[model samples]
Target chain A: MIRKIFVIFAIAGLIMMLLPLVVNFEYKDSLNELSSQYVRGSIDDLKSQNVVTSVIVSYRGLDTLGEVTVLFLATAGVGFLLKHKKNKNSLRKASELLQTSSSFLVALIILFGIYIFVHGHLTPGGGFQGGVIIASAFLLMILSDINLKFNHLILHLVESFSGAFYVVVGLIGLLLGIGFLNINIVPLGNFGQLFSAGAIPIVYSLIGLKVGAELTAILNTMGGEQ
Target chain B: MTLTIIIILGVIMIAAAFGAIYFNKLLAAIVSAGVISLLASVIYLVLGSPDVAMTEATIGSGLTTIIFLFALNKVRKENKK
Candidate 1:
């Protein structure tokens, strides 16, 4: 009873502490100086239509690299922890409806994932979202067929090469004295076009591939494969 | 109209969060958590951040739920043995 009372008091105290901030909060009418600069830089300098993408893949590319590294560590940790032998005998067949629909839907889902990352410069969706979408397609496949074998070699190669190439692209910018991960190495074609944004699309695509492979490897490991 | 929608979503998300904490079955709790993420993604879209909404929907709702289900399944199998 005392514990419950204490919990209630704690909750009340927390609410009281936060209430003033909530009450005093006012929405800003326009972007602040930093954000307005980012918006302008994204449009004029980066030639990217999506301000968020430029901020993520161009201005703050190193932070995104760190994020990808964190994801890689996670994938490695999951892989290390869940090293189980494949038990092919205990698998049950999926429903006929699932079997048929997943086969047809998987291709379209993967295509959509590709589209998302490819258009990351122009669209709201980017490498992480696209990669997760692709991984979901693999998850669907694993759900429909437990005995299905994913070639681990191919997954690892994709993961490693894409990560290496991401760094190499950044190095190219460094070699050109344009700063690391600068997207101005290649021509920033035309604004609002797929080919625009110079190395942003390329770097984002690499991120997409690496993330997709790492996630698929994680799912494959969790699906009872070593 | 937008305020009403946001209010409704907020209420539902709170209810789902409570359900997640209170549910006895692990699967039900996992589903409840997914529901919270899905609702949050909708709220993000309503708040004019489609990028955040996509990430929340795909990773938070979709893959996290699947990973949890996989963990649950593995645990259940271990218990049976």
Candidate 2:
């Protein structure tokens, strides 16, 4: 009874504290100075339609690099913790419906994932989202076939190469006297074009491939595929 | 109209959160958690952030749920052995 009363009081106190903020919240009608600058820079300088993508891939590139490293560490930790032991006896096969649908859907899903990252500067979707979508395709295959064996060599190669290329691209920018990870390493083509975002798409594509390969590796490790 | 939809989604999300806590079955709880994430993605879309919405839907709901299910399956198999 005391515990329940304590919970009630805690809840009430929290609501009392938060309710004033909710009621008094002022909705902003315009972008602040920093946001307006970012918006302008994204369009005028980067020639990128998606302001968010430019900010993530160019302006804050090092932060994103750090984020990718964190994800790699997580994948490494999961792989370390989960021992890859092959199950000798096969479990019951997945439903025919699942097997048929997944096989048909995997290619389409992967294509969509590629399109997302390739057009990251022009669209709302980007590298991380595309990478997760690609990972989902592998996950679907794993769900359909428990005995499936993934080629670790190819997965590792893709993951490592993409990561190395990302850093190399950044280095190229630094060597060119542009700030690190600057998108002006190449010609900023006609605005709103697929190739207009300079190095943003390339960086995003590398991120997508690296993220996809790392996630697939994690899934493969967890799924017990050697 | 948008406000109404947002309100409804918020309610459903809260209900799902409670359902996740209330459910005894681990699978049901996981499903409830996924529901919350899926609805949050929708809310993010309604708020005009499609990038965030896609990330939330894919990573938060899709991959996380599958990972949880895989973990649960592994635990159940070990228990059986």
Candidate 3:
């Protein structure tokens, strides 16, 4: 009986803790004019029609770079944590039917993913979206149990080149009159072209590559029977 | 009517969130958490925070769910021999 009372009191205390904020009736109009500046801007310059994309890929590009680096670091950290585990092949051999059919689908999906990345500025998808798609293709390779050995050195080379290039792109923006990640210095190109939006698309593609590579490496290292 | 529906949905969502947080089993926790994430996205849209809603849907729900599943696989492996 005492335990039941204690449970009831605890529930009441929890509700009391949540009461004030939930019951408040403050107007949100002031929040728009006052807080919009810090939260939303930069829709025009990058030729990115999506304001959120513009802010993330252009205005705050550096932060995204840092974020991707953190993902890379996480991949590395997870790899380290699993390093000492035993290693063997995780995927069993695919049946002949799946082996033949999946390759064509993989190619098509990869092409589609590229299409998504290239059109990011004009539409909704971008680096991260395409990157994950590309990673799935690599994952499919593993699932097929195809012993496709990747050149880790070349993989590292590409990763470093892309990472350095992203930084260089940011530094060049600082060098040129605009601040870091000043995406408008180069020509915006025609808004909807594959080659549009100056460095935005390039950076996005590079990000796609980096994310794809890191995720594949992490999956290979961690998911393999290790 | 729409507002009432939204409020009901929101209450259900918050309940799911707390349920997810309070669960002891790991896989149940992950699935409950996913339900909360999806519901949170809906709530974000209803509240007119579309940017935040999109972010919450994409990264918070999508990427985060995948990451959790991956981590859970690792945890499951650890719990085994």
Candidate 4:
């Protein structure tokens, strides 16, 4: 009836939409000219083993900084909306096994988060991914323990300092005639080494700290702990 | 083989999307949505973007699920009050 007709039409529409993808299956293993140039230049320009990190933290630093600001604004908006008026403890206490295991895992999770961001320039992970991992660890901690409190002061300090320092580094690059947010200000160490990728690692680490703190603060505020 | 895997994952994603929409319980729906996000991460991994896959898995599934649960709890509390 009408339902069957609707389903038929929906399927037809979906098939029509996806027809182009199947018909135009031209997947290229090699980069296009522009991307090939970027790939070749990145080694000499940024000296980062991970071209993705070089693009994200160094080439597109300002854009990433803007994204971070948007996140900061979003977290601030949430805090304003969900700010607790009365400190009424509402969360039920989790079980003993959950509590003990969560506490034990928190440190390990934090360590992993740090590792992901610290090696961002040399690995597939980066600041945003690592920051979310750290925030998830805090989320787990929040779930297991009802009475646990976060040090908001430390979170704020980390957020502000990292953001400011990111800008400061960019400004320094601008002053040094390396263009804004360029990694040329710092010497590109031997490639593939942890110390390589001038300014990329430092920027990503700062970004990781800032993002981790911002997300943790948002979670705390949403959970009515702030 | 890869095409078959992609087709299977796509089916699962569609099924999860339907479950998220049709489930009566809010918690069930949220969990279903998380499953959809996780399946998407797997697809991203298969498509040769491990970094995007990791981000989608961690943020889209992990943190978003918790946030939705918190919001659901708040809504339930307010409804009860």
Candidate 5:
């Protein structure tokens, strides 16, 4: 009797969870007014080929700023919670295969990450994706060499300056242009060119560097073991 | 059909989730959770959200799994002491 009751309750719970998807199962027929406006005006305003990048870095820029702040805070919180407490001698050496191959792979991974963020205006990828990729490369390096150390001072400098420069660019827009993060400071050379999007690439690169440094710092802190 | 494929993916995700909960070894459970996250990202890709799919795949499956493993290692080390 108890087993039957448990099975029935589980079935009922599953049905309840899935009921909303079944009820609201219809294809979207048209784009809403805000999205329609974004799609139509993004290229002209931002000179970015990728609509997603235009939306993220130009149109809804404030939201992206807030998101970057949240990530910074999360990294800081993790660092504080996992303060370096482990003995330095406790970390064992990595395997020979990992130690040898990571040196070759690390450069390629970092380069690929830079490429993804640098071409944010014209490509599918943007700052966050590239930043995480770079952090992953650093993670590989850290895993390979237990004795390796990143210069905390340099990481801090990079993170702070990039974040501050992102805001300074926004302030420049606010002072001399239409509004904050207007992207009209520099010439929008051409629609599809590498340097066409005035401030989009610049902003994304700053974001990428900031995020990469923050995440790498978090990894270093968490894996400190001392 | 797209719907059939989506249904199959959903079933697979559900199975992975259950496996994550029921796995005896903590490492196996963590890996099972990663599998569920990876499959969910695939579903996101199929649904035409490539951006979301990329974030989910890289963060959920890649960095998160590493972080969890590190945390687990720390905990096991503490337990040993």
Candidate 6:
């Protein structure tokens, strides 16, 4: 039946998707050996607040840049999914209690999110995690049944600007002959502290802001009525 | 041994997922798929990719369930007498 055909096609698709993993096995051993040495140097030099961020922004920065672009594309695509039709009264009125709690929660979340984003250079999480937390706060607002519509103008401004800044940071990397996103041009700050990793944390914060805005816009676009 | 264990667990997850699909209840099938995704994601974690594992669990299970629920509502409405 149609279901059987669908299953067959899905299996075929999965096989194709997994082909790369199998192919990559050939280099896995050699890659791991090389990384074992690099990992030691990274720890010594970067004294990174988070090992993952250091790896992302230092060792494998080029890949991180590509990953950000993927996220950017996803955000853009999802943005279209939640396109606004311009109805001021699209959502229902928010109860006073809901409004109070939502405002309280949103403020708290934004504050905590900022803390997380700033401390990313010194802590476990980076921009992406904090950004998602911020977006979730906005999603909470959307769920509060508030008729308050987010200003598309403000979101568009923030999104476009942050994305531009991300690329500019990469351009700085290019200038250093480090391809895209090499953070070595800027002084690597003290290991295990805020304001460290120079441009990496700053770029991460920009990514956070852009991601938070984009995700919130997407969720808002997919409103309750839709 | 590790590979064998992973393969065994993955097979079980896939089998359980198939069982869910074979059943008539859409919710059951969706829940089973979620379980399978979680299991496969854990394998990814064992292979040293917590990020990919997190994404697999989040998008594979979380977003998928939302989408299925949305479609389920539409289907039920279409079938209304």
**Model 4 agreement with the true structure over B1-81: per-residue lDDT tens digits:** 778889999999999999988999988999999999999999999988888998999999988998898888777777876
Question: What TM-score applies to chain A of candidate 5?
Answer: 0.90
- Interface RMSD, every prediction, one decimal place: 0.7, 0.8, 3.6, 0.9, 1.1, 3.7
For every candidate in turn, the CA RMSD to the true structure comes to: 1.6, 2.0, 4.6, 2.9, 2.8, 5.4
List, residue by residue over B1-81, the lDDT tens digit for candidate 2. 779989999999999999999999999999999999999999999899999999999999998998888889888877877
Q: Is candidate 2 or 3 superior in DockQ?
A: 2
lDDT (Cα, tens digit) per residue for candidate 6, span A136-219: 687777767656568889988988899888888889879879767767767887876676766767877887898788767656
Better of 5 and 6 by lDDT: 5
Q: Name every residue pair that clashes in candidate 2.
A: none
True interface contacts reproduced by each model, as a fraction? 0.88, 0.68, 0.04, 0.72, 0.32, 0.00
In model 5, the clashing pairs are none
Best by DockQ: 1
Separate DockQ for every predicted complex:
0.89, 0.80, 0.24, 0.75, 0.59, 0.21
10 residues in a row with least lDDT, candidate 1 chain A: A83-92
Per-residue CA lDDT of model 4 for A1-226, tens digit only, reads 9999999999999999999999999978888987776677778777787777877887677899899999999989988888765657666789999898998999999999999999998888989999998988998888888777888889889999999999998999889896888887788898889888888889999899999999998888776443
Q: What is candidate 3's lDDT per residue for A18-121, written digit by digit as tens?
A: 89878985766565662355344433445555555666787677789889999899888987887786535344577888677777778987887687677666
Ranked by TM-score from best down, the candidates are 1, 2, 5, 4, 3, 6
Residue-level lDDT tens digits of model 3 in B1-81: 558868888788788778888888877777777777777877777876565565576556655666677777767767664
For residues A9-68, write the lDDT of model 5, one tens digit per residue. 999999999999999999889999999889888777777888888999988999999999
Q: In terms of DockQ, which candidate is stronger, 3 or 5?
A: 5
TM-score of each: 0.95, 0.94, 0.73, 0.91, 0.91, 0.69
TM score of chain A per candidate: 0.94, 0.91, 0.80, 0.87, 0.90, 0.77
lDDT of 1 by residue, B1-81 (tens): 789999999999999999999999999999999999999999999999999999999999998998899899888877876
Using lDDT as the yardstick, the better of models 1 and 4 is 1
In candidate 5, position A188 carries an lDDT of 84
DockQ of candidate 2 compared with the true complex: 0.80
Alpha-carbon shift of residue A39 in model 2 (angstroms): 0.3
Clashing pairs in 6: none
True-vs-predicted CA distance for residue A172, candidate 1, Å = 0.7
